[model samples]
Target: MSLSFERTQSVGIIGGGPGGYEAALAAAQLGAEVTLVERAGVGGSAVITDVVPSKSLIATADSAVAISEASDLGVQLFATSDVGRPLAPQIAINLAAVNRRLLSLAGQQSDDLRGQLVDAGVRIISGHGRLDGERAIVASTGPGGTDFDRIEADTIVVAVGASPRELPTARPDGERILTWTQLYDMKALPDHLIVVGSGVTGAEFASAYMNLGAQVTLISSRERVLPGEDRDAAAVIEKVFTRGGMTVLSTSRADSVVRDGDGVLVTLSDGRTVSGSHCLLAVGSIPNTKDLGLEDAGVQLTDSGHIQVNRVARTSVPNIYAAGDCTTFVPLASVASMQGRTAVFHALGDTVIPLEQRRIAANIFTAPEIATVGHSEQDLEDGTVRGFVHKLPLSANARAKMMGVRDGFVKIIASEGSGTVIGGVIVAPKASELIYPIAIAVERRLTVDQLSRVFAVFPSLTASITDVARAMHIVGSDDES
Candidate 1:
């Protein structure tokens, strides 16, 4: 008997975002006939707009902050006057140049990604795509939008990402009032920036602009900022925001936003008014799953229009899968890529490992970044998980003292009796880089003692992780968080 097939397995992916890009590559490498339909050029919004450009802007902001921090270490920066006398240096950000550079970088990345897909033998379609029942995808191709191309496949993956949520009362004009995507068009920084909402997006922009020398007013409907994050972490960020000269109007709401002369005016729910040169609406995002023929294909979606998926990214329809912000998952780019690969693997009879929330790392890119992995302290309060927490402020770390750091901390969460590293949080500069080891421990189910045995470089920020793990180590099963 001989094992053979008449045709190779086929996969069709919608969108060219992180999820779709990874899925297309994986499927092609697996010797499956792959076709990827993308409306945008390539690399999607994550590389083209949201993550790449936003983080590049943040990097510029961090450089500006470093100038001030240098003074604390007795490093003075001075400018020479025309007569040769020393003068106080002025800090300026050429926002137009920054925007141009970041945008160019994003475009280059998108081009590189397209090249990779072509090299991997994945057919790339440049157009809008939607589900054609369960086994095929129909794309509107070419400049005139009249040409249609249909791809029939053994499996289909949907990775169309989401867009910023827009409220009718606070409509974005793309000039004064803008969404996050429109931010790169500004030639100069706003005289005053009013950020509405206190979620992760709002806080990040608020911090960035304030650090960039703009007057920022943050309006939050909750009593405190970053409502669902760790309380201590939120407090630290709030303190930093205030000290950086940001005005946080908590427990307030923006009822309406309208053009006020050359600026903008926001009417509050409490009968107050806040005015600024520009306003940003960072409330949330809605999935881009609309009009994708999901319902017609029997693919289930949440009431909010997000596609529902299982751990392996399988949709309600047997042969269809969804990933990225369009799926009802964590909505991070890394998670989306993982989900995409898992979907293809499970469909092609490859070894598949399901996704787990406890092993996913989340980060907020504020001035002092907040990063976390696995279970949080809030999980214990909800009665869904039992754990203890241990906290060690960054101020106590030797490297922090040498670097003139004053804010942030490292917190550890462990199984109550087993001392397994269940979760951890770090608040500091580049906390994203520091939180990875903890994520590994959570994924590998490493105990506190096991992690403490691993050596970290001396007098480094990561040494603090080892130190905290040592502090939280259980002796005879009676202690540690």
Candidate 2:
């Protein structure tokens, strides 16, 4: 007997970003008829512009940093001078070539996603799509901009991604002032770049550009960069930024940005001015929920226009689900993909696991990246869980010392009563990859003792996780002492 109903279930998804793309695939895999309407290409802004291109650019920047530090690793770069004198080779980013490469990389990723979706039997429609009541989607197709494709389905998924929030006083010219999406269009790195907003996006770009051999000044309205992240991790980033010659303007809020002759001038709220060749507004994002007929169809949205979604990505209307940055959940791409699958699974009456914030892992893609999972120090400070924290500096790790790494630490939180791993933070190079086992421990509610029993490779960064777990286990047990 088949689990699918007598009539094949239909899933109609708007926006072909990670969320919508995954929804279409998941629904089709469940033997449902799937139609995906995307204004942009498949893989959405994340592939076409945001995550892919940005990370590729960061990779280029990382290469530059590696070359600069290669001498410390006994890899010398020398150049002969005209007078038979030795000269240190200068590292320069071929920014136009870098931009082209990243864009091509992004395009290839988008094409791959489209190909996979096609193979999965998902009907892909290229147009702007909106919900027609609760059960149908109307898309404007064709070059004339008036042709419409009316599609009806049993289930509707909204994954329309958000756009960078723009302030009225500081409009993006795409030349002097730019959004994260507009950064790729830059033919050459700016002589000086002023980054407003101290969040993950701003900090990542600031770090990347500074490492790529551009002067960067980061203006943070908050006391520290990457607010709402792990405090210690943010401190490390700020220290790194300062030590790397990036000017940090903490507690300074940008009021407006305007083109000043050949440069852009940023006026702070305190009447101070800072001029740079370009400016980046990484303030925040607004969900693309307007004029989509969401409210008219009774799908509830928050005051800020983010779709109100349940644990399983369900909306006010049972048949309608929402996912991605457009939804009022964690705005990570990984989270969006999970939400998409979860939404489809719930709709199809399949085995569904509701998303929990505690189990979700988040990473900031800065140099010495910050990755975290489960209950944080802030969460445990006054929360219901009786947990104590253990911190291990990466400097003490043999692998880190061998690699000449000295700037990050691994912090773990475990319940005092059960010694269960509740949370962890890793501040190191590629901490994003290092945080997975800890994420699993948090998801499985594994005790520190159990976590310690897991073998980690010697002379590896991951050994620090097990080391911290061992330390926590000893701290939680009096009998061992």
TM-score of each: 0.97, 0.97
> Compared to the true structure, candidate 1 yields what TM-score?
0.97
TM-score between model 2 and native:
0.97
RMSD of 1: 2.3
Where's the lowest-lDDT run of ten residues in candidate 1? 1-10
lDDT by residue (1-481, candidate 2, tens digit) is 1255989989999999999999999998889999999988999988998999999988898889888998888889999999998898988788999999999999999999999999999999999999999999999999965999999999999999999999999999999999999998888989999999999899999999999999999999999998888888889999999999999999999999999998999999999999999999999999999999999999999999999999999999999999999999999999999999999999999999999999999998899889999999987876767789999999989999888786899999988788888999999999999999999989988888888888899989999998998887654454321
lDDT of 1 by residue, 320-399 (tens): 99999999999999999999889988888788999998899999999899999999999988877887888889999999
